[model samples]
Target: MSKITTLPLGFANALLVRDKGAILVDTGINANKKIYEELFRELDFNPRNINLIVVTHGHADHFANANELKEITGAPVLCHKEAVYALQTAGNSAIVPRNELGKSVFEIIKKNLPRSTKKVNPDIIVDSSFDLHPYGVAGKVVYTPGHTDCSLSIILESGDAIVGDMLVPSFFTGEPCVAYFANNEKALFASLQMVLQQASIFYGGHGGPFTKAEVLDLL
Candidate 1:
C-alpha cells in the first residue's frame, strides 16, 4: 500500500508519497526546506530514499525549492515540458486572472512574493501522461493545466490525487473551491473534470483531501 502524507508548509502544501521509495510532490517555497526535512525525519524517511521530485506547476511556491530538494535527495526533478521556460527564467509564467478573487490574489502575490532564486532545469520533461512505476509508485503524472499552463497532477492507483492549485480549500470556510487564482477558468473546469474521472480523493496545495462528492458539489 502507498502511504500518503500531506506536508503543510505554512501557506502551501506538499505531498510525500511512499511506496517502495518516496516521491515528493511540489517543494513549497525556498524557506520551507527545513520544515520538509523535519517532516521526513518524523516520518522516518531518509532524504536519500526519495527517487523523484515532481513539481505540479511552475509557481514560486510550488517549485521554488525543487532544485534544492533534488540536490539533497539525489533525485531527478520532473515537470511538464511547458514549465521549463518559467523555471529556467525564474518568471511567473504570465498568470491570467479568471475572477475578481483571482485578480486580487495575483496583485497580492506580485506585491509580496519574490521570484525564486535559483533556476531549475527539469531532469525529465513530460509532454503527456508519464508512468511512475520506475520511481516506485503505482501512479502517473498527468497534464492538468488551468491553474497554470503547465499544471500537472499526480494520480495514484489508489484514487488519491495531488492536484496543485486547480482546486483549493477556502481559507475562511475550508470548503473545496476552484483555485482563487487561475489562468483559465474554462480550462480549470475541464481539468477538474478530467481529474474527477480518475481520482476519488482530491488533495490540493492550499487545503484538501476532499472527497469526490465534495468536489462535485463545488463544481
Candidate 2:
C-alpha cells in the first residue's frame, strides 16, 4: 500500500509518497534543507530510497529548494517539458489574475515572492502522461495546465492527486475553490474535469487535500 505524507514547507505543501521507494513532490522555498533532514530523522526513511523528485510547477516556492533536496537524496528531478526553461534558469512564467481577489494576491506575490537562488536542470521532462512505476511509485504525472502553462498533477493509485496549483483555496476564507488565479480558465476547467474523473481527493500546492464534493460545492 502507498501512503502520502504532507510536508508543511512554509506556505507551500510538498508531498512524500511511499511505496517500494519514495517520491517527493515539490521542494519548499525556505529552510528546506533542515525540514527534509528533520523529516527523514523523524520517519527513519532512508533518503537514498527516494528515486524521483517532481516539481509541480516552475514557481519559485515550488522548485526553489529542488537543488538542495536533490543533493540530500540523490534523486532525479522531473517536471513538465514547458517548465524546463524556468527551472534551468530559475525563472518563472507570467501568472494571470483570474478574479479581483486574484489581482490582490498577485500584487502581494510580486512584492514579497522570494527569488529562486539555484538553477536546477531537470533529469526528466514530460509534456504528456508519464508513469511513475519506474520511479518506485504507483502513480502517473499528468499534465494539467491553466494555473500556469506548465502545471502538472500526480494521480496516485489511491485516487488522491497532488494537483500543483490546478486548484487553490481562498486566501482569506481558507475555503476551497477552483483556483485563485488562472492563466486560462477554460484549460483549468478541462484539467479539473479530467482529474476529477480519475481522482477522489485533491491536494494542491497550498491549502488542500480537499474532497471531490467539497471542491464541487465551491465550483
Candidate 3:
C-alpha cells in the first residue's frame, strides 16, 4: 500500500509518500528549510529517500525549495510545461503576465520571499496528460489548468486526486474560497467538474484531503 503523509508547510501542506520509494508532492518556502527538515525528522523519514518531486504548480510557497530538495535527494522534479517556463525564467514572479488575480497572488509571494532565492526547472516537463507507471507509481497526471494554466492534478489509480490550487473547498456550498487564480475562470470550473467525475477523495493545494461529497458540496 502507498502511504501519504501531509507535512504541514505553514498554510499549505507538502505531501510525502512511501511506496517503492519516497515522493514529495511540493516544496514549501526556502526560508522554512530548517522547519521542514525537522518535520522530516519527526516523521522518521530520511530526506534522501525522496526519489521524485512533483510540484503541483509554480507558486513560490509551493516550489521555493524545489531545487534544494532535488539536490539533496537526487530526485527529478516534474511539472506542467507552463510551470517549467515560470521556473526557468528569471523574474519577480513565476505567474504568467496579464492575469490580474494571479498577479495579485504573485505579488504576495514576491513581497514575502527572501532576496536571494533562485528558480529551477523540472526534469520532466508535462505538456499534456501523462502516466506515472514509468516512475514506479500507479498514478497519472491530469492537466487540470485554470488555476494558472500551469496547474495540474495527480490522479492515483486508487481514485485520489491531488489538485493544485484548482478547486479549493469553501465554507459555503457550490463555491470555493478561491477558484481560478490566473483569470481562467471557465477552464477552472471545467477542471473542477472534470476532477469530480474521477476521484472520490480530493487533495487540494490549499485546504483539503476532502471527500468527493464534501468537495461537491463546496463546488
Candidate 4:
C-alpha cells in the first residue's frame, strides 16, 4: 500500500507518496526547500529516496520549488507537455472564475501573487495518462485539465486521487465542490466526471479528503 502524506506549505500543499520508493507531488513555493527538508527528516525519509517528482500543474504555488527538489532528490521532474511553457518561463496561466468566490480569489491571485523565479524543464512530458508502476508506486498520473491546460492528478490503486486545484473544499462550509477557478468550466466538469469514475476518495490542493459521496452531493 502507498502512504500519502500532505505537507501543508502556507497557502499551498504538497503530497509525499511512499511505497517502495518516494514520489513527491507539487513543490510549493521556492522558499519551501527548507520545509521539504524538515518534513523529509521528520518522516525519516532520505532525500535520495525520492524517485520521481510530479508537478500537478504549472502554477507557481504548486511547482515553484521543483527545480530545487530535483537537485535535492536527483529525481526526474514530470509534467504535462502543455505545462512546459509556463514551467520554463515562470509564468502563470490565466484563471477563469466559476462563481463569486472564484472571482474574488482570481483577483487576489492576479494582483498579489508574484511570479516564481524557479524555472524547470520537465524530464518527462506526459500527453495523457502515465503509469507509476515503473517508478515503484501503485498509481498513475492522469491528465485532468480544467484548472489549467496541464493540470494532472495522481490516482492511487487504493482509489485516492490527489487532485490539484481541480476541486476545493469550501472555506465557509467545508463542502466539496469544483474549484473556484478553471481554465475551462466545461472541461473541468468533464475532468471531474472522469475522476469520479475512478476515485473513491478525493484529496485536493486546497482542502479535502472528501468521499466520493460528498463530491457527488455537491455536483
- Tens-digit lDDT string for candidate 1 (14-99): 78899987799987663555766787889888989889999898877788777778777899999898899988887766677677
Cα TM-score of candidate 4: 0.94
Candidate 1 vs candidate 4: the TM-score winner is 4
Model 4 off-target regions past 4 Å?
171-174
lDDT of 3 by residue, 44-99 (tens): 88988887788887776677667678766788999888777667652222344234
Listed per model in order, the count of residue pairs whose N, CA or C atoms clash below 3 Å is 0, 0, 1, 0
Candidate 2 on 109-159: residue-level lDDT in tens? 887765578899999999989999988888899999988889999999988
Best candidate per TM-score, number?
2
CA deviation > 4 Å runs, candidate 2 = none
State which candidate, 2 or 3, has the greater lDDT: 2
TM-score of each: 0.93, 0.96, 0.81, 0.94
Cα lDDT for residue 148, candidate 4: 88
Task: Compare the candidates by lDDT and give the number of the best one.
Answer: 2
Ranking by TM-score: 2, 4, 1, 3
Clashing pairs in 2: none
Model 4: weakest 10-residue lDDT segment is 27-36
Query: In candidate 4, what are the lDDT values of residues 1-219, reduced to their tens digit?
Result: 888888887667788899877799987663556777887899888989889999888777878878779888999999998888888988776667888988876676677674667788889999899999999999999999988889999999978899998888765576676888887888898999999999998887767788898888878
Candidate 4: what lDDT? 0.84
The lowest-lDDT stretch of 10 consecutive residues in candidate 3 is 90-99
Model 3, position 125: C-alpha lDDT score: 89
- Model 2, residue 68: displacement in angstroms? 0.9
